[model samples]
Target chain A: MTNGSLSEIYAKAAYPLLGHGKRNVQVLKEALEQYEGELDSDMYGSGKVIESFQVKMADILGKEAAVFFPSGTMAQQIALRIWSDDQGSKKVAYHPTSHLEIHEQDGLKELHHLEPTLLADRTRPVLLQDLREMEETPACVLLELPQREIGGQLPEYAELEAMSAFCRERGIKLHLDGARLFEVLPYYGKTAQEVCALFDSVYISVYKGIGGVAGAILAGDVGFAEQSKIWKRRHGGDLISLYPYILAADYYMEKRLPLMGRYYEEAKELAAYYNGCHALKTIPRVPVSNMFHVHSDLDKEQLEAAILEATRETGVGFASSIREREGGGCYYEVSIGDRYAEVPQNALQQAFQALGRKLRHTAEL
Target chain B: MTNGSLSEIYAKAAYPLLGHGKRNVQVLKEALEQYEGELDSDMYGSGKVIESFQVKMADILGKEAAVFFPSGTMAQQIALRIWSDDQGSKKVAYHPTSHLEIHEQDGLKELHHLEPTLLADRTRPVLLQDLREMEETPACVLLELPQREIGGQLPEYAELEAMSAFCRERGIKLHLDGARLFEVLPYYGKTAQEVCALFDSVYISVYKGIGGVAGAILAGDVGFAEQSKIWKRRHGGDLISLYPYILAADYYMEKRLPLMGRYYEEAKELAAYYNGCHALKTIPRVPVSNMFHVHSDLDKEQLEAAILEATRETGVGFASSIREREGGGCYYEVSIGDRYAEVPQNALQQAFQALGRKLRHTAEL
Candidate 1:
């Protein structure tokens, strides 16, 4: 039998559990089917469609206003830049593994000429103590809940409150990188508004856990939102028409938000299956959100082969690819969503058994 | 009888003589229906959807590579930044009315820290003489063909060739702001590639003159295009999915590109009708493209009322809005496209007649 790439193999499977579904135009088509709003396109962020979505997001986040951006990268950078400009300090602080520091090609530094201060070690979530210990005062402090790079880990709500208060007391603006905000809410037992209330500004990805095609919402006070509009134009985030994104964001938020709790439960169960394997374990030993990292003592090639074997035999796909760990072994992030619940229980059990068997063989080596 | 705003009245008319049609989701719906390509979403500017379109655009522009951006603002700025960085110069030059200088909230200045030198007076297109007269050598010179702000006027092709040679000889990178590139091609008797040949880099707006929802293509050498990808991500122009824009761009370019000559002819005929009226005259006195500005001796209220009366009576919409001229009177830009030809010839004549009669009555005052 021919061996295809894992993603190719997963794509052909009966139950490929990951995200809401495949990233395709079908996602947009499905979202459009659910959309009951206006058909008119927005012009450079104007008109009813973009405005209504912005208003809805702002209300849900309990901010005075909100602006929609084409990407979370632009939204987050502009949010920090605005705060930095207002404070007359160019320094901003965030976790070492923050999207700005890693993913954005130093846009914050190169484009905006703002200095970024990495707050803590890359392996853990930033704590309140990390803020208090900073030698230099930053214009803004950014916190990404369910720290994605480290494996979707989040600090306690009480700890978040203390950090928020500490930042507020020191006249530092706090911004939330809530790209996977909805995924973390079930664990916090807080509404999006309650969680957002702790930060001066918040940016959320509509495309991440929400299963929208692509877009983001940046929420803050009236003035901040207004300023973001100008920056949106400057960044070219203000496309002539953003209604498709707005519609999809609106549709998916409605469809999947209520299922966050269920997805969280599914994630825990799935992680347990992985842990049952001889060489496999999950980071944090428990998931705080609907996503967690599955690590294996086996190298990437061995882990991939085992997952592929399980997927092909039982028709239950695990992951498309695995990342090599710094020390040794391999890992992959498991993000639970609509697809997770659709995996047949019996097939899932068989797939895990197959995976366990392969790992047992590897452990014997 | 209750009187509505001119745009409100125009929107209700049977033949709104501007653009391909309405700017709505239906544009996307129609484009999607015509698309026979892959439905897979591009993840952060990867995948076949975006890649194929970029390749197609690069081929059409005769460039080694191309990059798609959410807006022309981002594409143009990045193009200029790359040129400036390569030349180790921060100064770039463009027409006084360039979109980068006027419409982009000083993004080039603020984000990239590039200095802009306005090359010529706002009322006219930049001449080669103007380039020769400049004291300081700029890293790049941006030339907007059929410059939108000055009523879509263009310099002679020979002048363009001369400027291109002079810039090349002086180590100044020449960039084309070809937002309305297709509209001017009929007049220049040049293919897009031929026109783009003079410049080191080129940017085109798919939305304007092409009637896509929104997007821009920046094309140049392979290395330049590769660097733009990084800048695109930095500016957040690299959205998770841009297939909708790509599909629409592809669909409309196929539909409308060959019809540029027809639109150009219609524009001239329409401009003649305006000039025939007592108080109306078109900028250029003769249109060199599918777009031109219609100036009226009448004030804003007078002009709007007269057009509103003609639109309501004849069901042939002229314009939705008018802008006040610097000193006095008012004017509006007419961009002829699919909708212009759809207007019945007889109805168009009568509409202009009504417009002329109203202007004559006002002139009697």
Candidate 2:
């Protein structure tokens, strides 16, 4: 809600595939009300429906137990706090670009009073070399799937395994900020459980890719999950009833989890089309997930207006608003979803073509 | 979710009122769907309806601003942490029965590292002598209105004023855990703002007396309230959308807040009826809020079974489960609400008569 971000996000919510927005009321209402089973009691975020979803998530993620929370920020923070407490170290490692470091306003430091050991370069995954270079041991190493900050790029599997081994050999905790875990699972070519086995705890977003209304599931061993619930209650994320989010997540996970491979392929196709343009470039020539970013030389506001106008005129939402990048460049993310997959690539290409001509015309004007 | 508390709570939720429950789904659904106004944009706890409710709450509490949270546990903990950080001291004083101390799983200490300076007796409100006897300065003094743990007991307004003045002179913050603020306001015969004027900050439960499904409002000066939003985000209290809770809170506050006086009177009438019983006792003898406990000489489980059986036998539900009190007494809370408000006193008295008979029979068996 800062600096009118809520209103800005609200403004964007009016567009479908608003560059991958997960929440919409009509969509959510239909998703929720269509449930045929009993609307289970919403007590402490547990019930047959809520627990079923949580267990399925744990099974998929290959963890022993799981708990749902109102937000991932709370889940990730709690996971870190639990690991720190268990390992008896207040220091934890995460990329500078990690959601906890950037979006959470230094919650790890201010709220938990924990020291953060910044690991690796911000542009990519945490390499083993980064762990070797740290001055002091951290209680946990936090990893985000596909490194959302830099266009959903992930390191090679062997590289991640070495990083895991590095942390394991030192008896440090391994945690995953898997907000987009489902989106990037295809890149690993392994089951979520298989990928998750290397980590001590994993936090999955319900709304991001799975298209639940809003919530998260943190998976780990029973003890860790139990501790996370306590932390969740303490942090206010222990909502009285999480049925709406849980039921929605269950439906969406079942609906969307299987489509990730196609979405990933669509991302590549979309990125290939975007890169063919003279002024737009995809950060990773190939997307490691169902998402990629299009860095544009065009002005951000202008590009957003053009894309939005094109969306309205042609019903082809090529992208959402453009985010101005550092060093005077502007970019917008392209997250391929079921909604985005519905539009023909030719329709998107035409929208981009019109956008380029419109930008050229604006330059002429 | 602690020590299977969630499961236990869930088990209790199967029956209406669990003897001290706050919300239900059918009621919530009807209340939510009947809302005729346009659904506000799902934002970070703000919108026309949400902000309007927040501003109205601030006005009612005599504070500069108010922010809504999904849970009171989060609101109070964040409120304490904020006051502690602002004063540069972590030690905070409260009665042993304060929600933060008893129910929050040491979040104030574990998450915020704030030292709790326990004060006063658990069975009664904090007196001036308690503050006078403090060994060291504290960052804040937390008080719960008509303390829920003690069947909603409140100190004399003058005593509270003295305590507030003592903290004011010492530059200590005074935070009120007013989870049932509305339910108790009639006892003081003061408006919410007038009574709230004594405290530096106050947290009111939207779900408890107001009948919303779940959420809380932490009210304070402009700076404190503004800072709370940041803390809320950090703690994962800031959800993508809190419109449901906010809208429900708005509707319930409007529908239920004005009934406090009548409910307060009803509680007195009900307590008078119960105190007239042979073995059952209303702790305060007179009502302080719309709630009080009925302590009985019978066994806890036997009393609970009798009440449930009575509820099942008669269409009227007169009471809820009894909690075994300290010193071998069994007790249960009677929180008067829309459902309980409808039952006549005669019906309730007869139910108790039947309960006594049932208990006697069980004793004989």
Candidate 3:
């Protein structure tokens, strides 16, 4: 069955553990109730709703200023471009699977004419040693904390500090692709400001962990923030009224920031359960944040059937579909959020038991 | 007083002759009530809400496809860039006062590396003769309907047909900066499709005359529309959830499209009122669309005081603020909309009469 059909089935399951729920107009409706002041839409990224959220985010991230953008892709690209322009170098560096490199269709290269050096192996996070060993130093070094492609894996905090120092000493700008920044805070044992202190610029996604509609905040020194606003207008990220996004972001950030620790705990708990299943293991073996990827030795179709069987029996679904590996296995990403807590403990236990049985039987066959 | 304070006064007036009303959360709330189907938010510019709207707009504009954008600036830039790329030329042409040349911080130059040759003098539309005399042939030519910078003026339909035929004969792409496309339909006595047929691509603003929160639609042939989507993602115009914009756009277009003829009529009537006042006259001496500019020989401060005085006495407001001319005069733009209908005729007459007396006295000073 297609992923769409699988989602339909999973959506009807008694216990669904993906996101808060469907992202719909109701999402905005629920968030709007939280706002008490004038809902005056922000005009070209100005006014109270947008400006207040920018200020709050900047303060939370301990930056001099922040600007909201329509996407993390735009914010991060502009962050690197600004740094590259200042350093008079066109080269920036990130992991091989960096969103800019993979997801953005070479927007940086095409739009900004910025060249990127892939600093690390695709399977792991870029460490301080990688920066030190690189043949050519880039103007900016982007570190995606909880590097998403490798299943929310983050380099050690000390390693990040070392890299930050190295970049600063070498006059290289260090930028954070912190799309899941808040999710990793519980594991890092630090506040958002503390983690952000190590980076010259930080780009955070409001929709990812905060469960808002889509938008991002790029925070840095006042000059960087000012430059980003100009770039934002150029990129058309300055929607005349971004208050819908700002309102949803402000409401959800307030509601979800306090629960990040719980989500992280739940991710670890869920990963442990997956590891107990037959032919299944999670990347990192344990989650460093509220997200992880579950891998299976069986191919995608086999795992899909097995998961479908288990979900049908237990009324507790896993993912809608799985991605096939190059040679053999399959995998799917899991992100723990508010819905994870709603899954009944007994039902989850029963679901895992069924999943384990189905995988084992499928393997034997 | 600042424009912000003036807006406060105008907002409170009994006969506010501007937009429908305050653009707040209520605008969205009212629009959401109109949607009957699934309110699922579009994911990365896909799904039923976004797709259906794109299809509807493309049909309305008589194009093979269309793409929704966060801003008209982004849409038009990408449209021109695509045509330039296809034609294997780096040069485009537009009116000197085109939004690209004056407002966008030279994004076309900075991002796309496309050079723009300004074709027309700032005071009028770019006619066929202007294109013929341009020193070099550009890959694309942009025309902004109502030529906003010159007070919402337009060339004759035959002149537009000539321009289109000239561009097509020479294999040059013609792009319409149709921000106020609907507003001009009544004057042209043509459907949106009929007008759009003359151009290879058209970009329409959702918020300007449609009274939506904010968004834009770029409509063209299938291939052009597809290429625009890639450029959109590169520019980060593809927000994760654009349902809020889509809902408002759909709702407001339906609510306002039928009223375009009425708004156009009201605009002409309003221009006459301005022209009748001492030292006050509208550009074109009449309106060709639902929008026009009212200029005064008096200075900005003088006009502001006169406007404030008239507004206070008659409870009818004209504009929040006036823009000073290069040397002496001052002007303000007015676009007729739903709010204009609510303005009592007697009050408008009295307001203008009082405005004329105040202007006559101010000019004598």
- After superposition, the stretches of candidate 3 with alpha carbons farther than 4 Å from their true spots are A36-38, B1-5, B36-38
Model 1 lDDT, residue B204, Cα: 96
Candidate 2 lDDT, tens digit per residue, B1-365? 13233234334433332222434445445455655433544666655656888898899899999998888888988888899889998898898988788777787877788898788785688889999999989989898888788778889988988988998999999998899988888889898998889999999988787877678999999999989989988888888767667767877888889888888887888788777655678867798899888888776766666666555544445443356777786887777776555556566666667666666677677
lDDT by residue (B1-365, candidate 1, tens digit) is 12348878878899889888788777887777765433778888889989999999999999999998889999999999999999999999999899998899999988999998998886789999999998899999999999898889999999999999999999899999999998899999999999999999999999888899889999999999999999999998888899878888999999988899999999999989988988999986788999999998678888888888888889998888889988899899899988988889999899989988987887787
Error of 3 at A194 (Å): 0.6
TM-score of chain B of each: 0.97, 0.89, 0.97
**Interface RMSD, candidate 3?**
2.0
Model 2 residue B56 CA deviation in Å: 2.7
In angstroms, how far off is B206's CA in candidate 3?
0.6
Global lDDT of each candidate:
0.90, 0.77, 0.90
User: What is the model-wide C-alpha lDDT for candidate 1?
Assistant: 0.90
- List model 1 lDDT by residue over A270-338, tens digit each: 888888878899985789999999988788888888888888899998988788888898899899989
Tell me model 2's lDDT, rounded to 2 decimals. Answer: 0.77
TM, every model: 0.98, 0.90, 0.98
Looking at model 3, residue A17 earns an lDDT score of 75
lDDT by residue for model 3 (A1-365), tens = 66776777787788987777777888887887676435687888788888888999999999999999989988998999999999999989999989999998789999999989998886789998899898898999999998998888999999988999999999999999999999999999999999999999999999998999989999999999999999988887778898888888989999999999999999999999999999999997989999999998888888888888888899997997688887899899998889999999999999999999999999899
DockQ of every candidate structure: 0.63, 0.44, 0.63
